[model samples]
Target chain A: MTILATEALTKRYPRVTALDQLTVSVGAGVTGLVGANGAGKSTLIKILLGLVPASEGSARVLGLDPATQGQEIRRSVGYMPEHDCLPPDQSATEFVVHMARMSGLPRTTARERAADTLRHVGLQEERYRPIGGYSTGMKQRVKLAQALVHDPKVIFLDEPTNGLDPQGRDEMLRLVHRIGTEFGISVLVCSHLLGELERVCDHVIVIEGGRLLRSSAIGELTQASQVITVEVEEGLEKLAARLTETGETVAVEGRTLALQVRADETYDLLRDAVVDLDLNLVRLEQRHARIEDVFR
Target chain B: MSQPTGVIHDIGYRHYDGPRLGRGAGAVALWVYSLRGTFGLGRTFKSKIMPFLLFGAMMLPTVVSIAIMALLKQEPMSYTDYAVFMQPIIAIFLAAQSPVLVAPDLRHKVIPLYLSRPVTIVDYIGAKLAAMIAALLILLVVPLTVQFVGEMLIDLPMPLHTHEYLAALGGSVLNAVLLASIGLALASFTPRRGLGVASVIAFYMFTLAASAVLTGVLESEGHRDAASWSILLNPFFLVNAVQANLFGTQPTEGLPFPSGAGPALILLAVVALALTGLYARYRKALAA
Candidate 1:
């Protein structure tokens, strides 16, 4: 089911159009909103959250119109903003509990939920420390914790792994995956990194220059192409010659050959050629189309 | 099926299926939070210094008055004059604390976090203004209440009238609302706390000084009516004039305006303008 839908939505600022007649539908599961900086990712999220009004067209979030029912939409949808929005003087416990109370949880329930959410986000002892003293990864977890403490139907995470080391990014991605799958919360995780989203996002929407570039399921977008890469330890030249003689297109790299898998029997043909040539097959794998290729 | 190798631990991340109290509850929560923030309740010790100091300063005069009444056997001050006596301290308190109520949220860009909640811009602005007014009311009323109770306990010279005391209390509340609205309206203009504090102080100091000088000059030139009108420019004198009129007390010296309905009307107009400006400021800030 479509959770968020924007129809020809446009946002025009004085000097630039932030979102220009963009139209797209986002469904459940972990969806990645991929765009370069200034590609209108933040603007689109703001429009969906009703933080900024669109200049033209219409948008609906969770079946509520943003123009009139923005408060209702926000009540059901949680948003983790892209910028540094946490107050430095407040500890994660204080801030998240306050946010939970703001979401209408009773005082005791708010505290309990905040503690649970903080623990779930991997912030335990540090939750008591002021956010000013937190590392970037810790601060990001606090941000995520506040968003989850409210327990909304969906969350719009803008650049969830923006500033993180490789390990931190991987950990954050794992958490995002768990939030969507284990917690059963739909997530619209925004990021400029195409490869990072490829792991956690079930669907990917690519926008460029404030317009829709592509929106498809991750499986469809990254489906295996008709190209197979074969690496041989020895007889590389012989393998290349054998593949060409069989009327197959082949591109020779340093130590491997990229051949087209024209038919299901193409694998058997290549295997037979390798065996007949007495070539040692080091590797044979089909190349999958990456989400980045759609942008290119 | 193979038995599970790992234990299923309860992580305690339960979904909230309870009552969602919607916008009204959120506004009340924000109001309470902002009120606590005004006194630095949930903040560090460094953040609590200014508020406590100013509050102590506000209480100092009443304490001194009570001491003089007990030790020297004299009536040094009255409830009617409490606001004027506490004017500078109150101004400092408002100047210092208004930014505490507003600037941090904007400076941290947490306004978006707030806006993304179920509350509207009006609800957010209203809650903040209400919080500031409540804080200022406490600052305005507590010292006066202490003086009233002290005089009753010591049997001071002045005759105690419940009606007059109630009027003074009401006027003090009005005074708090006026000052808080004006201070918060100005503080809401910028995200920088330093700028917010500087602008609020500058506003109060410049207007009070300019009006005092202007009223003095106009009165010296025998322009009594013009002088009375000029005092309205300074919120301190205007509130004093209205309070004197409300409490049935003589207008304090340097108050160009006489105790009458005209000054009261002028004070009400200024409050209306301040409130309107406050509303407009938050409306614009939250529009994005």
Candidate 2:
């Protein structure tokens, strides 16, 4: 299903156009919104959540019009903003429970759900501590817990891994992955790093200068290309010469030979050439196009 | 089909399929939360100090009155005049705590989190204002209630008129709402709690000073009508004027606004203006 759709949505600030005629649709599963700073990623998320109105064009979230059905959309869609928005005076449990109640949960149910969400987000014994004393990663988990406490149909996470060490980033990404796969929640994870989303996102949408650069399934965008890389222990020069002589496009980098695979038999031919040259085959693999490569 | 390898234990992350109360419930929740926040309940000890000190100060006048009535064998003060006597403390409490109700949310940028909920901007403002008004009413009414009860218990020789006492209580409520609306309105404009406190205090003190000076000059010039009209500029005097009108008491000692419908009308107009400014400020804030 198309969970969110924007058609020529535009947001104009006094001195700049934050989002300029951007049009895109996002479906189920985890989708990454990759963009540079000031590329309108935050603007687009704000527009979808109905926090900000578009200067022009129309948009819908979960089949509800943002202009008229903002309250309803917010009730069904969760948003985790990029900045540090946690109230320092409130404990993680208190804050998350308050948010759950704010999302319309009964008091007891809100508490229970808040505890469950905090546990799911990997905040256990420390949930009772005031958020002001929490580490950056723990604070991020609290923010994530509040967004998940209500169990909304979809969530917009803007820079969930904004500040974290490598281990913390990995833990956050794992939780995000589980949220989409295990809980069956649709996620629109926004980040500037395209490589991070390549692991968890099933689809990727690239935006630049407030415009859609590309929107495609991750599999299609990062499909295995026709180029295959072959590396041998010896006879690098001979293998390059032999592969080019067979009308195959080949380029040599160090001891590795990168050749364009012409047919299904291209692998057999490369194997035969390695055997004929009596070279030890070290690595033979097809290069999959990366999401970063598409950005370049 | 192959048997499952891992056990599906209950991690308690169940989906909520129950009836969602939506925006109305959310607004009520916010109201209660903000009400608790006003008293610094569930917050740290440092957060508790200001409210406790202010609340203790508010109760001090009643304690002193009761003590004098009991030990000194003297009638300390009249219940009807309590509000006029307590106006300064009320002003300080309102100025200090109104920011506690509003500024942290804006400073922390948690307004977006609130705005993203089922509630609208108006509901958010309404909840916060309602909480402030409730807090202010408690501060205003509790002292009067204590005074009334203490006087009754002490059995003063004069017959206690219940109607006048009730009228005084009602006037206190009105004064609280008026002061709370104006204080929150001023605090709503700034995100820094210190700035909010300073602005609210400055607003009340400057207006009181300016109006007092203007009223004195006008009275010296023998412009009685102009002096009476000038009292409306100071909210402290305006509240007292309206209360005096309500309780049918003598017009407050130096201020010239009459104890009649004219002062009451000005009081209501000022409250209306303050409330309008509050609503406009929140509307602009949430829209931004």
Candidate 3:
């Protein structure tokens, strides 16, 4: 079922149109909003949250109109903004509890949920310390904790792994995945990175230049493509030239070669070329289409 | 770094089935949060230092007045006069603490987190204004109550003390309204806490300096009525004028705008203007 949807929605500023007649719908499970900077991703979230009024069209969040019923919509949905929004002087538990209260939770319930949510986000004894001294990953956890403290029906996480290292990113992705699957909360996680979302999201919505580019389930978009990813120990350029000489579609990206498969013979042609050139082959496998391919 | 940290340990995610209150509760929560922050409650030790010191300083003179009244067995100062005389301390409190409600949110860009909740822009503003007003009322009422109790015990003038105490309390409310609205309005303009502090103090100082200079010049020029009106330039005097007129007490500044209820209406207008300024500022801030 559709949890959040915007139809022909437009937001015009004096200098530029932030969202130009954009239309998109997101169902349950983890959905990713992929876009470059200035691609109107943040603007769309603001419109859905009723932070700004749209110039035209209509939208619904959790089946309530954001334009007229923002307060009600916000009560059911949580937003983890991209910017730094944590107060330095406050501890994680204190800030999260206060945010729970802001969502209209009673004091005891707020405190209870804050503790549970902070622990759920992987913050342990450090929850008692001031957030000013927390690392970026920990701060991101606090941001996530606050978003989940009131048990929002749907959570909008903007760049949940924006500042994390590879290891941190993996951990955060796991957390996002659990929130979607284990907790039964619909998730809309926004990020510029495609590969990260490929791991956590069940559906991906690609946007560009304030318009919808594509919206599809992850399995449909990331299926094995007609192109085969060819990685070699050496002779990458020689292999590309040889594949081209054999009348096979081939493209080289850095050390990796992308050879298109026209028929079953495409794989046989690549294997024979590597053996004939006396080059060590590292990998020759069917390529899964990347979410980044949407931009192309 | 604190321990062997990265542990993927999660119990289960429990769904909240408890009662979620409406907008009124959300707004009250914000008010309570802001009010506690005003006096540095639930904050760091360094943050608590200034507010507590100011609270004690505000109460010092009232303590002294009570001591003198107990021993002398005479009227040292009337209850209303304590509020009028303690204007500078209250001004200091307003100037120093108003930014505590707004500055951090602006500087840290946390307003979105707040707006993303059930609270509206007007609810946020109203809660904050209510919080600051409550803090000021506490600062005034505590000392005033102490003096009222001490005087009653020493003199045994129950009816007179109760009447004057209630009058002083009414004046205290006026003082809180005028100071908090104006102070918060000034603080909301600047995002930097230091700058917020400076603007609030500078506004009070400029009005006071202007009022003091004009009052002196007008009195010397024999424009006595103009001198009385000049005191209204400062908001503290504006509240004083209204309070004096309402309770039939003489304004220490000059005549209490002998032209009935006009000063009270004008003071109300200033409060209205300050509130309008705050609303406009936050609306613009939220838009950005």
Candidate 4:
């Protein structure tokens, strides 16, 4: 079921329009909002959260109109901002408990929920330490815990893995997956990276320049990434010779090679091909589905 | 190697199915949290220093005055005079603590988190305003209450002292509103606590110094009317003028307050403007 939707949503600043006639519907599962920075991802989140008024459009969260029933909309929806929003002085537990109270939980329940949510987010006794001493990953955990402390129905996480290293990003994505699956809470996670979301998101909406580029199921997006593209600084001919010798069709375009995955072994063969040829690999990405691929 | 058959128990991730309190509870929670922050309660030991130091300084004069009065069997300082004389300490308290109440949220970009919840702009600002005004009221009223109790213990005339104490309390309310609004308005503009602190203190000191010099010069030049008008420049004197006119207490400026509700109305207007400024500030922050 659709938990939130925006129709013809547009937000304009004095100098530029942040969101422009963007219409999208999100259901009760993990939905990825994939867009680059300055591509109206934050603006759309704020609009859905009812923090800012859209210039010309209608929006709803949890079936409540954001313009009129903004309070009711926010009551069920949580938001974790992309930026560094945590205060340095308070401990994570204290901050999350305070946030729980802000969400209208009774004091005792707030405390109880704060402890549970912290543990759920993999925080331990370090939650009692001041947030100023926290690593980036710990701070992100605190942000997530606060959002989940009151048990919101849907949580909007803006770039939840913004500063996380690769392993941490994987863990965060797994947590997001569990939130939508195991915990049965809906999630709309925003990120600029396309590859990291394919594994966790059930649905994906791609936006660019404040406009919807594509909205599709995870299967469709992943299907489009089956064709791997690789770019190398030199020795492209030698690499292509090695790949073609391995019985895979290689298309050449300006020193970059595009190959379709005939089997799961194709990726290993491709990596070996480059290493065997001693090619200076400038780029090696399987998920580099271009804008043309998206439109297609 | 044989796989060990270890079963893992369920750890967590329970749904919160309890009753959620409504807006009133949320507002009260925010207000109390903010009030605690004003005095650095539940915060770092370093954060506690300025507020407590100022509070201790605020109480020192009243304690010494009460001790001396009790022994001498005479009145030491009037409640209104105590408020007027401790204006610097009160100003410092506002300068130091008002930023503690509001600026950190801005600097840390915490406004979005609050607005993203059920808390509206009005609810958030109202809580903050109430918390700060309450803190200011407490700072001004506690000394008045302490001295009032002290005077009663010394066997001062019950009727006269009670009446005077009530008037001071009334004046203290006005001062709290005026000072809190101005201080919070200044604090809300920039997230830089240093700037908020400096600007608030500078604003108070400059106005006090300027008012004193201008009034002194005007009175020396025999411009009694101009001198009386200049008293409104300093917020403490503005409230004192209102108190003098309303309660007929001794004017702290040592000048006859121009009669009527003019001073009171002007004080009210300044308060309204500052509050409006603070509201506008948070509205912008929320939108951002």
Candidate 5:
């Protein structure tokens, strides 16, 4: 089921068009909003969360229109903003528990939920300390914990891995994946880096210049192409000749030979080419189109 | 990950997973932050003690009065003398120190966290106002109260009277609320701490000086009512003028604006208008 939908939503800032005629339907699981800076990623997320109003068109979050039903939508949807807005004087425990309480939880329940959420986000030891003294990764966890503390049905996390080193990025990505899969929460995670989203996101939506580019499943975007990349130690030209002689199409691409073999005869074709040419096969890889290809 | 050494741990804490605090705790925490921010603590040593120490130095004359009274033969202190000498000094301290309570949060973008939570804009403003008023009360009222009590205990010439005590309390509360509201309204204009502080001080100082000069000019010729209206432009002067009127001690001998209920209601209305304007500007900034 579609958890969120935007019908021809557009938002125009003073100097730039932030989101232009962008229409998208996002369902359950981790749907990645991929774009570079100035790609309207943040604008779309804010609009969906009802923090920002669309200049035109309509959008509904959790079946409530963001225009009029903002407060109701906000009550059910969580948002982790892109910028660092943590109060330096506050501790993680204090911040998250306050958020939970703000979301209408009872005092004891809010405290318990805050503790549990903070632990789950791996911010256990230094949670009592001031956030000003926390590292970048720790601060991000606190931001995440606050968003989760409310126990919203869906979350809009804008650039969750921003400003983190590689290790920190990986750990954050893993946590995001767990939130969608294990915790049973639908997530709309935004990122400028398409490669990272390629791993964790079940569905990918691309935007550029404040407009929608493409939206598809990760599998479809990265589906294996018709060409098979084969590397041989010797007889590269001979293998190409033999493959062509057998009515199979072949071309040399860089250091590897690209071949088009019939679907059923693909394995047998590789076996015969190796035996007849007396060649050593070094590498065999299927040529799949990456999400980056769509950008180009 | 393994925990770092003690020194690193002191500087770099991992996120903790403890029981969270509620609204009361959150307000206390915010109040503490505001207090530390006002005193400029948690940073350089120079900034740490400078604000409070400077304020104490500014109150040297008041301190000297108490010291001399204890050291030598003393006469009864008149209410008029206390109002003229001590009240203005306390007003300066209160007005000058207003922005420190809120400027840091505005500059650091720290207010969003609080606003995004369950707390309303009203509570945020209320807590800040409460902290400033409490500080002012501690500095001004407590000492004055002690003086009033001491006069009764030592059997001074003029013992404490019910009317004097009630009048003083009511007048100070009005002055405190008026000053705090004006201070917050000025502070909302700027996000920089220095700029915010400077603006409030400059606003009060300029208005006080300008109104005094204008009042002098208008009274020397004619149009005393027009001069009374000039007090509307300057909150500090208006507050002082209204308080004088409240106490039946208008400086001008000619046109009396009736300082009793009319001035009080007008002052309250003006304060309410200023507060509403300040809150409107704040909400606009938030939307921006």
Candidate 6:
């Protein structure tokens, strides 16, 4: 069963259309909600989380209607919001433990769970210190910890990689990936940058103007256009001429020649083309389309 | 709905990100987080120094009152009269302070955490109001009790007997609760904290000044009793109307200050309506 489904889900603000008839179905595992800023990514996440009511259509999370069943959905779903929300006075231990207790754990159990969760987020030594005293990286970890402390069914992470340094972004992406594949939890992670989602998501849902531009498995998105790129040292003209003579459609794009190939014949054609041309095949790989390519 | 794709492994405390428990448990989790918000303690860290600062500001007058008491000998000021003078001033200060407690959450966008939870908007407003009033009670009402007790210890005539004291406590609590509610309502109207504060003060100014002007004009025109209803239009006047009844003060300018208990009660109802209207507006803005 689809963990989430939306049918023509639309949300309209006074001045902007946040989501415009967006329809998508998400299965288990990490699904990346990919779009640019103002591409309705946050709006979709809000609707899915039942925070913002949709102006049109419908949506469901785990078969519960997000519109009517917001509270029920939120009860089972964890959300790590994009903005910073840590209380300055309380220690991470106190805050997360309080959250754990609010999630219905007993006093002792909540404390244990908070400690365990904070430690799990790599905030062991500093967990007792007030969150205001922590660094941004540490603060981000606390945000992640509170979302996980309750052990929710699925988590909606809106721009988890936002405002992080390169290393922090890498760590956060790895954590997001682990949340799905390693921990076996379903994740709906949103990002405006396409490449980032490509790395961590099993399924990619691209949205524009609050509407679904495309929704497919990550592999499928990269596979639909079978264009193989090849680079050779010198003899590049000969390689293109030889490949053209052999009835392969070839075009010089930058320093490399991009060849349209049938999925099944791509390997055999490349092998014969390389041998026939006496060219040094410095590199050969399939040309993957980027999110930018879709716009172009 | 995905058929529980993986096992619910009990890793005790590993950094895995799966749903740990059930939805019923998640609701409970949000409730606890809501409490943190009520206390002005959240992941954004607004609670620590802010609440204490607010408390200190609200109770500054009490500190001044204590200092004044120490300088005087043999109870020069009647405790009842002095407390009456201080309570309204405290209420005004408390009213001004109430919106500050709520403004940060809206301005900071910290409300998303609560909105994302299984909590409804009503619960959110209720919790905020309760937290603000509770903090005000501690800051404003508690000190009044302490002062009353000190007056008794100083062997001065207790203020208005036990009943009077209870009535005073009740009046203060009502004032705080009503003022805080009004503050929250006003705060909800704007995202700018300054605007919220200014609007609340403006509300107090317009009501009091208008009532005072009308009453002054009425007395000058020899229609003393006609302006009694104007007292119902101002919260301060309405409160004073009740105070006049309780303390048996002489009619100001040959006219009953309270008019009748009926107008004051009616004014309270009107204030309630205005507050409700403000809350509705705020909720709409939040929805937007």
Put down candidate 6 lDDT per residue, B6-86, tens digits, no spaces: 774547435433344444444445444543454456544543455556556545655565555555533323322323355
Q: How much DockQ does model 2 earn?
A: 0.65
True contacts recovered per prediction: 0.77, 0.70, 0.93, 0.88, 0.15, 0.36
Q: Please list the Cα RMSD from the true structure of every candidate, rounded to 1 decimal place.
A: 3.9, 4.2, 2.8, 5.5, 5.8, 7.1
Docking class for candidate 3: high
Off by over 4 Å in 6: A8-22, A83-115, A123-139, A223-226, A262-278, A286-296, B1-84, B87-96, B143-160, B189-214, B226-234, B243-255
Compute the DockQ of candidate 5.
0.20
lDDT of 5 by residue, A71-175 (tens): 566656677878887767667887787567665566687787788888888886899888889999999999998888767778889899989999999999999
Point out where model 5 deviates above 4 Å.
Answer: A13-17, A89-115, A223-225, A234-253, A287-289, B1-100, B111-160, B211-234, B246-277
Model 1's lDDT to the true fold? 0.86
Give a tens-digit lDDT track for model 3, residues A138-162.
Answer: 9999999989999999999999998
Residues B1-288 of candidate 4: C-alpha lDDT, one tens digit per residue: 988799646675788788988778898999999999999899888988988888888888889879887777667577887678999999999999888888889999988888887877788888988888898888889988998888877865434477778889999998988998999999888899999999899999999999889989999999999888897899988998899889988887476777799899999899999989998887777756
Please give the distance, in angstroms, between residue B142's alpha carbon in candidate 4 and its true position after superposition: 1.6
Q: Against the true structure, whose DockQ is highest?
A: 3
TM-score against native, each model: 0.91, 0.91, 0.94, 0.88, 0.77, 0.77
Task: Arrange candidates, best TM-score first.
Answer: 3, 1, 2, 4, 6, 5
DockQ of each: 0.67, 0.65, 0.85, 0.70, 0.20, 0.26
Between candidates 4 and 5, which one is better according to lDDT? 4
lDDT of each: 0.86, 0.86, 0.88, 0.87, 0.72, 0.69
Q: In candidate 1, which residue ranges exceed 4 Å CA deviation?
A: A233-246, A252-256, A264-280, B1-9, B70-73, B156-158, B161-163, B258-262, B276-284
For model 4 the TM-score comes to: 0.88
The true-versus-predicted C-alpha distance at residue A263 of model 3, in Å, is 2.2
Interface RMSD of 6: 4.9
Model 6 CAPRI quality: acceptable
